[model samples]
Target: MIQLPLTPPGQTPLRVMTIAGSDSGGGAGIQADLRTFAMLGVHGLVAVTAVTVQNSMGVKGFHEIPLDVITGQIEAVASDIGVQAAKTGMLASSAIIGAVADTWRRQGMADTVPLVVDPVCASMHGDPLLHPSALDSLKSQLFPLATVVTPNLDEVRLLTGIDVVDSDTQRAAAHALHALGPKWALVKGGHLRASSQSPDLLFDGTDFFEFDTARIDTGHDHGAGDTLAAAIASALANGSTVPDAVAFGKRWVTECLRAAYPLGHGHGPVSALFRLNG
Candidate 1:
């Protein structure tokens, strides 16, 4: 039987890390990741790769953090605090991707922990987040080390060249990504026709599972992907299997989206703090 992490006493909380960018608007990126971690009852750590000037409207510009600083943050956390699972998002350049991949390997996280990779190529508002030239490096250096790769429709198309117009093409996109060496691939269908039914496809190279929720019509789903990926990492750290983690993450996202609110005049972000509502 699986023992729960929350025991009688002296049990430390599960530790999860996010290797991603910082969003000034606090809607997505590390903000959303940490929010999800806290909500899911885990300790969150961060290694910010970029600092973006963004908001509900769109991303204006971003500055990639130096490789040394990124490594320093990861080492500081991994050596002392220790992470059970980690997730990566918004690796803006090839240099950063290579550096993170190297660091993660050196730390032995590739073999010891579950690493969820969110291929954040573009922002929720359609702003490009990663450099076009860094695409190959992300696929070559990081994808192989990932335990699970999470990509949306645009990212799937960017990585596989398949226009995911329907369920059949969506399956093809997930298989193409699974071919890149990640043990599992989760193709987010929130931006595809599957969004009508709020379905996300999970492919493990052999079989595919579709997890769905009632589609909530709202523009405040800006941080939904980041939140979902982070929640999965948190759940994995807390001892849930990949399928359970994905299902729980989807349910959590649906709840957040259902309670979403307008934070700004433009399209807003989902309410990660929805637990406080009831």
Candidate 2:
């Protein structure tokens, strides 16, 4: 019989938690987050708030986990193992969002743990992931507790009634979003059609850091937001400052999109292991 080698103590990996939905497609949501955490050398934990029946084409259906179950999962992971940072994605309803925020506040971990909120209201294929009524609850409960709020043009428009088509509009939207109480707001420019290159605007309530990258024209970009937010959370868990983590996360996602693989009939997924291959 082969004997397993025993490892030394205190060699545990950096832990990061994701409070989000589970995508059966394995391209976005918690699945993408877990893959990103693994690639970035962080231990990934999940508190599943909903389960989505999605595919390469689009989201077929979804079911929300009970509020108690969601809170129980958060408590179970946060109490025993503990997490350095966390990210949220694809919350199904207003009640769910409120429950999660309340639980986190009750645990008194809001200040200690860095939380990245990816306001994922719709799928890349234009399918609705969040209920319409949940929008207000998300703004009221989740946004205030976030260390950083990552929103694309569509989500930013939904969050703040501003159209971010040009650079000036982008700046205005970023500042408006920052006023919503998050320490930082990263307004992504993937939907900005005027510019040939993608320019994401980052506002830390004071200054703006614009990250411009050549947009990789590919159909395989199913989990870009989840990937970015997860990478930021992992970076934070590894002791990076907010701005540094956002920059690193953007770089990682850009590389991932550049090396994306064609896997499905419709939009596939970005390669989360691009760094390893290089």
The numbered model that scores best in TM-score is 1
TM accuracy, model 2: 0.95
TM-score for each predicted model, relative to the true structure:
0.95, 0.95
List, residue by residue over 190-229, the lDDT tens digit for candidate 1: 8776356877999998889889777888878888889889
- Residue 188 of model 2: what lDDT? 92
Listing every candidate in turn, what is its Cα RMSD in Å to the true structure after a full C-alpha superposition?
A: 2.5, 4.5
Query: Which residue pairs clash in candidate 1?
Result: none
Clashing pairs in 2: none
Superposed by TM-score, candidate 1 places the C-alpha of residue 218 at a distance from the truth, in angstroms, of 0.6
TM-score of 1: 0.95
53-96 per-residue lDDT for model 2 (tens digits): 98888899899999999999999988899999999998989999
